[model samples]
Target: MTTIGIDDMALATAHHVVDLADLAAAAGVDPAKYRVGLGQDRFAFPAPDEDVVTMGAAAALPIVERHGAAGIRTLLFATESGVDQSKSAGLFVHGLLGLPPQMRVVELKQACYGGTAALQAAIGIVSRNPSERVLVVASDVARYELDSPGEPTQGAGAVAMLVAADPRLVEIEPVSGLSSAHVDDFWRPNDSSTAVVDGALSMSAYLSALTSAWDDFAAHGGAGIDEIDRFAFHQPFTKMARKALRRLATHTGAALDDVLQEATFAYNRELGNTYAASLYAGIAALLDGDDDLADRRIGLFSYGSGAVGELFTGVVRPGYDRVLRPGAVPDALAARVPLGLAEYRALHAVQHPSDVDLTTPSVTKAPFRFAGLRGRARQYERTA
Candidate 1:
């Protein structure tokens, strides 16, 4: 197999935010219950003009600008927050980013694991056709019932990657540890826009899948806990990843440090859970926040509710630090307009009509936005 992996990555989130403190105060709960207990400070929320399509396009635009879209022959979009069941979300992104028409456009879904599945597929495509490039974009808006236990965990974002031979960011090893089983951890029916979650069972499933994948990886002569330099995990709440590391430490007899969790999952806390995009967002945070990752090994575990898991590793490219746009993630995060409890609640509550022309104003300042629904078709546009 030829070497293949991410050449570049970009992160984008909804421009609206709500402090977890605001959420707690509105719910008549202690602020620390969210700030410290859930390990989230603030979370990004979509404006009426933003959704997974717009976010995914915004994230991928930078990658195309740097690498050029000519070599990209595959576009894999991973998401749980899909706009339409019949149409692949990749089609909207293809036009938005102006990728070539000859590409294979696909939309993948399996909850959070969708990102990993898209990435693996991209790797396979590039490995077969080393001269071609693949664009893998994972985006989602994690929504739950208002005033529910999962409310604070809700978030919106996207992570876009350019995959090709001799990648600048990292080189993915062909081997992976995998596990899957049916579990009533989380799901959303076609009739509803929100998820139904068994929080306790979901967390248990995540840990169990990680353990199984880790053991399988070890059995296949993968790295031991001591051999790995850092880790990235699918974080629904940032605290859950800390718990996962603790479990690994106990299982492998490794002495782990507390700072490691902060390094790996701090983005999840800031951005909240992004569903299919969650794990890749963690990886983006690791790559963006840390500078000493050059030539270091990164072990990653991905778990999706209902439930599938995989453990894989990648080696950071030499001079990988130079490939990223410095201060981009932080700048995008800082630029978010803070929302009051009422504004936030009202924004989440508004439902645009899909069967007719939409009257919602185009309000997002992002490069790409959902213009409206026109003639029962979702419409998106590039902003000036």
Candidate 2:
């Protein structure tokens, strides 16, 4: 059987970034509390003309431009920060990419796990139809009430992947370890703009889910505790991922050493939490930080609050280094302009404007951007 996996991948984050130290100063808290305790350097947020749709499109447009839209038959958009309840978010991206009209597009929701769900589904689709290629895009804008416990973790970003046979990047194994249960560790009500979180409860639940998923994976012929060379995890906060690895080591009694790299999550610490795109963005950061990963086994863990968890494995393809675009993440990060506390507060309010007629001249510099709301219908445009 031919192998199937990620062929090409790309990532996009908000155009504006706010330094955590600035936020800490405004809150009258020690900057170290957020920088060290949370292991976050900065938090990302969209510009006035940006959102999940625009960010998602920006990440995916490169793939379509390179691979063309010929064999692409379906698009799976995974997002918790959906702009609409009824329509699929991928449709807007499909239009932006100018893909063929006869295509399948749908939005997935399961908190952060929605991205992993979309990936698994895409792999299954390719198995049934080898000729078809699937576009998987995970995008989100995590929000929290001002000064709330979850506010420091707020972020926005997206990841786009091209999944097909004989991929140039990595080949995903079919097996996965999964754990799901009804839990209210974190939740967002339909009427509210921000999420409600039980911080301590969430941490405890996360540890439990990690061990359960690892055990199931071991039982299902997955790699042993320390067998995989590198690991990528869904990080709501960078420090939580560190907590997970330590817990996994204790659970399996394995001395899983030297599998992590400073580069693996360097960008993530700056991004805070991107919800659905967190794990994939970590993978990009890992690849961006290192080369020489050919034929190396990698472990991936996905978790979503409300909540679902999965542990899967993929092996780096031969000559994977040559195809990867290094410095992409760093380049994007360097391009962003910093937002002052007052500017951030103003933009946050503008994002949730009460008026629907938000039509105005587009000010965003991204390739794709939200062109404000026209009679409650969200409009988008291409700037370049």
lDDT winner: 1
Structural similarity to truth (TM-score) of each candidate: 0.97, 0.97
Error in Å for residue 184 of model 2 = 0.3
- The residue pairs that clash in candidate 1, if any, are none
For model 1, residues 217-263, the per-residue Cα lDDT tens digits are 99998977777888888989898888888888877788876326466
What total of clashing residue pairs does each candidate reach?
0, 0
Model 2, residue 375: distance off in Å is 3.0
Clashing pairs in 2: none
The TM-score that candidate 2 achieves is 0.97
Candidates in order have lDDT scores of 0.89, 0.87
| Deviation from native of the Cα of residue 103 in model 1, angstroms | 0.7
